[model samples]
Target: MLLKTFGWSFAVTAAGLALAGVLWGWKGLAIVGILSILEISLSFDNAVINAGVLRKMNAFWQKIFLTVGILIAVFGMRLVFPVIIVAITAKMGPLEAVDLAINNKDKYEHLVTAAHPAIAAFGGMFLLMIFLDFIFEERDIKWLGWLERPLAKLGKLETLSIVVALLVLLVTAMTFATDVAHGGGDKTATVLLAGVAGLLTYLIVGGISGYFEDKLEEEEEEVEEAEEAERAEKAASGAQKGSQGATVVGLAGKAAFFLFLYLEVIDASFSFDGVIGAFAITNDIFEMALGLGIGAMYIRSLTVYLVRKGTLDDYVYLEHGAHYAIGALAAILLITIKYEIHEVITGLIGIVLIGASYWSSVVRNRREEAAGGEDAESKAEVTSGV
Candidate 1:
């Protein structure tokens, strides 16, 4: 199962190593290895969230996520996005941007790094909304009841998350926008605008997806009612038929289209910091793309694996951990705009939060098993007594 699930990842990793060797010999191979590790370490939470969303989609959409989405992640975001940023910001043409990256590596890195304020605000705001919306919505299962329950109550007030997000963006602009190191001069306005753009992107994408999902739900409910009504007749006639009529399709058609777009945007927001952080390790655009692309293959495989194996169902709080990691990353991105925090630190925080949540889930499972055992023993004793 593992081999079948992750064959593509293995192929990609091999290709990455070969590409690195062909391009820059042994040193390039080593750099690609390091970048791949860095990318994987930073994005485990992304895999978890992707799993949660991907499972809701059908097999066809899931395949597109692995195939087409991987292309976008590797070539589009990792390679082209930075060049476009530099071209726009430096007021240079695409060819000049490419030339700058090749001829003046430091200048290329500097240009990309200089745009961090806007990137951080935008990605941070989008991710923050994702985290806030997840935690605020009421759920039968609560991972961090102490914090989540109260927040869920507050979530009863519609737009609470949007309001909070706007306030945070305002404070971020006022506080860090003036910092000479981060948001120099008029950059604060740029950051604020980017943040608003992020918010709007989330609202528009999420709103469209939500509408289709609701329609799917209503269709499923209607199908179930019809099925129940006909069950008696079918049973009396000694006929059995498989499920039919609208069948609660898993994010089919237009629903899948919009959700796919949502997934891509979310994936982009997750990768924004990773792209910026990669510059800290190496300034080579091709190297960054090769390494991160290899890691991205594995992450995509992991998402599909989790969905197929129903890992989220077994480890109930795993989703909670991923969202919390996202929340932490969002805050870190915003903080990074003002202060230069190490990528290692950012990665570690996510690992720690996810690790703690996993441990808690294990403990809870053990306790439930023990309680079930005790109850069974008591019931047996009473039965023997009778």
Candidate 2:
């Protein structure tokens, strides 16, 4: 199993570097390797949360996720999306932005820098939406029962996120229009226009997709019922779930793929902070790419490890721990959209949240065990009638 896991990872890493080599050869490989590791470390919580979601899925979807999701991550989000950001915000033509991103490393780096606030805003709001969605929606078990009732009434964090996003964009426009201007109307107009354009993309495209996503609830319910019935029949038949554990194998694959998607999304979110912060460290696109790519590898491997070891199941609330981390990360992203918090600070905050959640889960588990022991002893005493 270990060999199989490591082998696939090695293949993926080699492929990524070989692609990198098409541009900068051995140097590119060295750089991407370093970056991947950094991303991996900062993304520990992301992996945990992913394990939780992936565990719920079937194996076939998991394979499709790894194969299809990588394309989405590498091309859709990383390559195309950044260029799209540049085209609208930088006021460059879309194709021109893509060409520049390809050929002119320094210019492309500048676009990413200029694009940070918008990226941060998008990620922050999106993450806030995630946390809110988790809170209002029913959970399998209520860890935050105390807070759930209050948080539940807030009604769909996704909707609220869109509102917050619009507010941010408006505020940003005013900042550029009135505060940062050298009194040039056209430049301010461009900023204002770009802000509107970005806002429209979020609202019309991103927002609609998010809002309508809830409509799929019926389809999800039907799928869950069928799955539950199958599980019930299996348990009653007294078949041992051993090496032929197709169910488990299926689950593992699901969990791995979800982790893969979650990792990509987390990396995408973190990239706002990371890629923006990278400029402060080095303007050289090659160095930044190298550092970030290497970091990504580590995050991916960590995600796989969490799944392979059944960390989510073994640790119980580890998934909760990670989402809480994500919540904090989202908040940090929101703050950084305007204030520019340091990467170390953002990462440290996430570490603390996950650490605290793990501690809480341990306490909860111990308490439950103690209660169970007491109950068993009470039953024994009652049967003895002494």
Candidate 3:
């Protein structure tokens, strides 16, 4: 199972090391290893959250997520996205930006780092909305009842997440407004616009998935009714066939398309910190890509493993912890716009929250099992006239 699941991860890591060696020798390969560790450390929460989303998708889309999705994460976000930001922000041609990255590495890093405000605003807002939506939506299990219960009650207010996000953007923009006049070129306005773009992207992507999910539900219901009436003896098998068939045939194409896009955007948001933080470690663009690319490939494989093995179902509060970590990360990203924060601190915060939540889940499970065992024992005693 390990080989089958993580074979690609191993292959990619080997390839990354080989390519790094070829490009810049053993020293370059070592840099890639360090960068890979950094990316993995920072993105544990991302892998968990991705597993949650991937669990909801059908098999076909899950395959795309592993195959095509890895390509986008490794290439688009890790390599090309930063270059595009530099090109747009510094008003340099793509080739010129590439040249700068190669020769004038410091200037390239400066240009990319300078664009952090916009990048943070966009990614932070998107992730903040995700966290807000998760907390607000009603759930049978409440990880933190004191906090989550109140949030769920507040969720009754329509568009509450959007409203809260807008208020946050407003305050953040105003806080940074002074810097714009100090030669930051309207940093506040750029942040506001980017935040709005993030919000809109979430809404559009979510709306598309929801529409298809509803359609799939309706089709499943019809299939169930037809199966019950036509073949009562074979109802179970027939219903299974109908559901799988609907997913494979009717629901696979357009639904998977939007879901694939949604997953990609979500992955991109998670990569924002990793990409920016990489500059602090190395100014070599190819080194950053190879190292972070290997880390990203492993994350994709981890996502697939979580989905296939039903890890999310096994660990009930894992998703909650991941979202809370995301919320913290989002806040940090926005704060970084005004104050520089170390990536180590950012990564540790996520690790701590997720660890705590996992511990809580274990405690909850054991307590419930103990209670169940006592109940069973009591019933046995009464039935035996003890």
Model number with the top lDDT: 1
Model 1: per-residue Cα lDDT over 1-386, one tens digit each:
89989998998899889989998999999999988988888999999999988888889999999999999999998999999989998899999999999899999998888898988999999999999999899999888899999999999999999999999999998888768364256567888998999999999998998788788878777766766777855542223223444245543566777888898888899888889988877899999999988988898899999999998888888899999999999998888778888888888988988888888889889999999999999999999999
Better candidate by lDDT, 1 or 3:
1
Model 3 agreement with the true structure over 1-386: per-residue lDDT tens digits: 67888899999998889988998898898899989988888898998998887877788788888888988998889999999999999898999988988899988998898888889999999999999999999999989999999999999999999999999989988896437422265587889999999999999997898788677667768766766765866536656666667664576467667777888888899899999999888988889988999999888888889888887777788888999999999998888887778889988988998888888888888999999999999999999995
Global lDDT scores for all candidate models: 0.88, 0.60, 0.87
Give the per-residue Cα lDDT of candidate 2 at 231: 93
Backbone N/Cα/C clashes per model:
0, 18, 0
How far is 121's C-alpha from truth in model 2 (Å)?
2.1
Candidate 3 positional error at 276, Å? 0.6
Which rank order by lDDT, best down to worst?
A: 1, 3, 2
Which model is ahead, 1 or 3, in terms of TM-score? 1
RMSD of 3: 2.9
Location of the lowest summed lDDT over 10 successive residues in candidate 3: 177-186
Candidate with the larger TM-score of 2 and 3: 3
TM-score of each: 0.94, 0.67, 0.93
Clashing residue pairs in candidate 3 are: none
Ranking by TM-score: 1, 3, 2
For model 3, the stretches where C-alpha displacement exceeds 4 angstroms are 180-186, 232-248
